[model samples]
Target chain A: MTSQHPTPGDARPGGRTARNTAAVLQATLDELGERGYGAITVDSVAARSGVHKATVYRRWGGVDGLVRAALEHSTERHWEPELTGSLYTDLLRLVETVTSGFTEAPEREVSAAAVAAAFESEEVAEALHRFMSDRHRRAAVIVTEAIARGEAPRGTDAEEVIRSAIAPVYYRLLISREPVTADDLRRAASITAAAAAAGTFTGTPGPPTP
Target chain B: MTSQHPTPGDARPGGRTARNTAAVLQATLDELGERGYGAITVDSVAARSGVHKATVYRRWGGVDGLVRAALEHSTERHWEPELTGSLYTDLLRLVETVTSGFTEAPEREVSAAAVAAAFESEEVAEALHRFMSDRHRRAAVIVTEAIARGEAPRGTDAEEVIRSAIAPVYYRLLISREPVTADDLRRAASITAAAAAAGTFTGTPGPPTP
Candidate 1:
């Protein structure tokens, strides 16, 4: 049964509400991984989560809402690279994080399901965009640091650099259906680094506008 | 009824079989563009194409087979860039072709559906892989030409260069849910060209090789 207010036990740090939400979100991801977005439903999620159907409905609204929540949760836990002062190392670390999703089974399943869901649902699309934007903004800090150190041009597009560095790996993963190896990751970073150093990403004018 | 033997007119280019096959494939793409892969069915395709359900079933084997045929047909018409002798011009031509799909409504719809289908179905996945590989191989010729002309390094990974040039645009198109612009196309080409000319994609050892 759905309660109008949170239970008294919901007040604590690992409370009933928190535990239930965790179980529900985890169940949502598991269902997505197993069956993809089209096959998932709130009823199935509730059954798998062991939470009451009414609570699942009342709390998450529906399947789309649950998927958005689960994606947000998953991306919150996703890795961000540690800045190593060198653009190449920072980029390599970032590429490692991104390529790991394609290489590892669990991550790959989740990513594949998310990507599928984005094409199927507007809510998932918005959530995915937000998630990627957040990740890109965080990773772009490396490029910003490089700019400060003169490792990259003053006007280099940080987000573009980060996106370009990882785009080839993802292109292989999602589009071309090719295996993304460590070598591929290294090449992606190296190519992006080379371009960035060459001012390829800089939005500066050509020939001083003469 | 399923016919064990081909009709006399089946062998002719403009005959019944050829016409039916063309109609069916066209209907399949229309269905994919309008409703996407999840909503496609053999019966619907048969009805839409004005072909008998039995004929559709017998000829293509099933929905997957029909989808594969449709995908093959679609890719057959997909544009390949003209060789411009200069790598920059050639890559720009190639990027224009790829980005055109995103900018054009009909092609964008079909592409979005195909991308969505690749995530959802194995048949579409195989077809998409083959299609992209064929296109990539064709586009890589430009990079090979560049290598031969001494415009790029000898070991520059031609396929990688092509993929890298277009990856950002595709990444924004599909993943980021962003609108790709002509500026993005030019930037992709320029950055990839810069990297390729710098020998970043050469599969060579850097200073730390020792």
Candidate 2:
């Protein structure tokens, strides 16, 4: 077993090292989707990726590292929310995409596995946090555009708006294990858009309840 | 293996069967908390509960049935959202309770495990669905009371409001893997309450965008 880990210098663009990293991460994701986190091992990932075991361990350290790295690798892929010209439509599209990701095949297994893996590994959990935070930041643009269009106030927390619009969808899909109905999606988008317009998400404390 | 399965006729309140059922399900939850879903087995639960392995299998069928039964058992325990005379405070308390269930010990492990297990078993998924649906129905009393008090419109979707108030917390706790802050709880409650009063949650269609 090599004690030395791969350095940043090994990450040169489009090199053999990059190719190997891509293959290993993709294989790691596939293995996770197929067998889940508990059954995946270094040898399995290495065999699936066609990368040598020693190299896999030398680079990723172990299964936790491999899963975490795979999540981080996914963040590098180009993704942006569809801008549907209005805040409500933009949020509706965003939530629709979120629902599809879990309901659709192939990606469904990988998505659920990633969330499940987080419970078992702090490393994977933190990577998921970073990945989700990145998505949140990217999705905040729709709220920002809405603000410019006079749909919401200047002080609105854009990320919180995104959270409001999509969180219910996540709740139904994963935690509640309920089917995300069309009305569910519409209610989430509409409530969030209206709340934004009402200045509820501006972060100001509400007046004390009488 | 026993060819026959447990029947409801075997259940007698305050009888040996009742005690055994309680012990087995509690042990199942304990095992799930400590070892997670993947590591739990009928034998382990039986050993922990001090019930015989054959009895456990005969009763629960296997690990999946044990988990599903445990979740169903949890629903039987009396649970109601706090009524704080207003929808906002009630939701704040509700979300606080949710955040605590995931961040605190003992229950936290089991809560996280149950959600993770749903990804692995359709039986557990359906059970979780029933459990959360039961929770939603019970918690809707707060909104029902609010409607009576004229805080929200008569037509507001009570369960949907509860979902909106708590979904972001779940998203942060389980999906995004972020720490739930006081601000997050307050914001969720505030947004949902304001939207409830605004009739955004009444299931009415919004005006067509220009």
Candidate 3:
């Protein structure tokens, strides 16, 4: 969706700048969803955003800069799944949110375009890596809480557990081109939970002798 | 590397046709490895293969056709990992071969380009899906062997098990932009083995009561 841009001479400088940035970034995502990375240009983003081309160039420098900024902005606004106390529920919630993007056509198109961009552009790759790292760090809290509650062994690698939990969904999405059904999400959660409980994800040796 | 082309008028018609196909496909991969999917054209493939542009156009129709043919040819020649009887070992071998493509620069470039192309082109996506399906089916034989040997549940979904085992490696390579290390492979094998033993991958309920 295209965002509303502020008038050029808005009385509030901070609000105006924020709205401008938001409009440009939203336009970037829309363009990415429609045209993909290979075909998108700064002029298209500027035309779509209703922002002056000079302003767009002055602010973002180029398409690469705009793409990185747009991704970062999206990740910043992304909602983290609430931790529901149970690790399995928490993981399932997270997985559902991740896979839900694929179930919706617009969101899936944007995600697919972003993924293709990551492979082609180092700027997008680094930005995406940062975005995913932040997401994993947030999701890892479930594992940490589980460890504290003795649901998982101490020294369990939280990020690794989260990664293992979601890997299958992404594999199906990007590699196999399979529709990631809810059943797949449930299975991924179950598999990761079973493995974590079995201490398969602990980075070190078994717990010290009791 | 570009493959040697067949002479214009070889006595054996079948042999000459096969060699021409091989050369064109190799040239496609070489071009993909160097220029990526977004930039590649049929003229480049023809030039690289030492084949006339008209022949390339007539035979392959367009870039999409050439890409599909090249990927299918590559998949046909691809070596399936030898089944090692033990499910864990078989999965590990398969994962290693898949991740090994990322270890070398040329192969990694080609793979990264192919992944990008899959996102951009339906033809490439279908080709990649078919290629991966063949691999998963071959790897599923390990799971079947495991079932017959009483290592896994009788109703274990072999393809799902195989997908679960290798998903983490693909996740790290594509989404996380992280290296799929030997330790990662070992851990994937261990985690999948534990989950399978726990019946997490069995699509149906546990074995029938004795």
Candidate 4:
């Protein structure tokens, strides 16, 4: 991979080039924490990474490009899939992982800053969307597996359930300025899981009137 | 209330003044139809309502003031009480009311825009949060009522359930660019409802291990 940017040269398949791309992404995250998306420019990143400016621009083009590459490494390295076989257990695990990584503590400082940046800029928003969607795809795989096992119930509406598990933490972070905790993730996980298992996507399913 | 930027001789006792304030709020909603919040200024609102700039300023210091004033009369004229005593029914009604009001044919444009503006602008976001927290108090009343009725299972985390109900719709509106449909609202209501009703909130209520 081109040290400044991943290109055909890096794509030709050698561990050395792949390692360079990894370093660029690593530096990107480092810079993200030191200087958030709003302040971090391509020039600064290259200087920090000891890479040429051409490498940074040629591969990622701009902030969005660099950040997307950053997410490619950060989200994967930081987040791991958990398969507990039970949909509720699995979802709860997923919720805990997400909160622990992206929402709750030190990670939230970096991740939330990025999400807040998305609100301020359209390009950043798109990059954030792409990154989140990719992560969503991973969660989707787990949900689909649960559905196959009948753990998620019939017509569980996996997408809605997945989104439901997430919304509150982010809501609290950006809107309410409340702290998102392990307890919060647990609560979200519990509600979404129980609903998904019971097939709550059907209707209100309130106690029937006599 | 004080008039724009604080003016002399604007103070009054009650009755007619309260009525005038209400009139101003209605006018604000009407003006919002012609322009979204970004397009709205304290000046435009004063111009539309035919109130003095000082009067508008005296009442609301900034955009937050205008938005708070506007929200007073613009939402559901009245909410149905948490009767029927079923939390699911109560919550379904609440979600449907909010989503329907925004999706309503005539008011949809400005209603949606106003909500969007609440998030997009810093001044408006705080106002909107305070606004939602007030509304959330109303929903909380329903959950408290559920606990009183003992219809909610033991150890139920009602607050989490309620928040989850609204989360997806907000996500759909703000991020996904989707209409908050009756169906979507219902699914959200149902998911939160079914799981909550099951007493899953207390602990490890995952899929069946068998």
Judging by lDDT against the true structure, name the best candidate.
2
State residue B10's C-alpha deviation in candidate 1, in Å. Answer: 1.4
Which portions of model 1 miss their true places by more than 4 Å? A1-13, A204-210, B1-9, B205-210
Best model per DockQ = 2
TM-score for all predictions? 0.90, 0.91, 0.90, 0.64
Best prediction by TM-score:
2
* Reference contacts preserved by each model: 0.46, 0.57, 0.53, 0.25
The TM-score of the first chain in every model comes to: 0.87, 0.92, 0.87, 0.77
lDDT of 1: 0.82
DockQ of each: 0.45, 0.47, 0.43, 0.21
What residue runs in model 3 are displaced by over 4 Å at the alpha carbon? A1-14, A205-210, B1-14, B205-210
Model 1, range A66-128, lDDT digits (tens) per residue?
999998987788566689878888898898888887667787688888988898889999999
Candidate 3 lDDT by residue in tens digits, A1-210: 123455665546456777778899999999999889988899999999889989999999998898899889978885666788877777888888788786677687788777789988899999988888888888888999988877788988899999998899889989988888778888888777767777777774321111
Compose the digit string of candidate 2's lDDT tens values, residues A1-210.
232445544666665688799999999999999899988999999999999999999999999999999999999889999997899999989998998898898788888899999988999999999999999999999999999999999999999889888899889889998888888888888888887887778766452233
Ranking by DockQ: 2, 1, 3, 4
The true-versus-predicted C-alpha distance at residue B26 of model 4, in Å, is 4.7
Candidate 2 ranges beyond 4 A from true positions: A1-12, A207-210, B1-11, B207-210
Which of the two, 2 or 3, has more lDDT?
Answer: 2
The local lDDT score (0 to 100) that residue A176 gets in candidate 1 is 88
| Tens-digit per-residue lDDT, B1-210, candidate 2 | 232444533566755688789999999999999999999999899999999999999989999999999999999999998998988899999999998998898798999999999988999999999999999999999999999999999988899889888999999999998888898888888888887887777755463232
Q: For candidate 3, lDDT tens digit of each residue in B1-210?
A: 223454665535455666777788889888888889988899999999988889889889988788889889878875656778777777778788778886676687787777778988899999989988887887788888888987788888899988998899889988888877777898888777766766777774321111
lDDT of 4 by residue, B34-83 (tens): 66654677777777776777877877786666776676555435654445
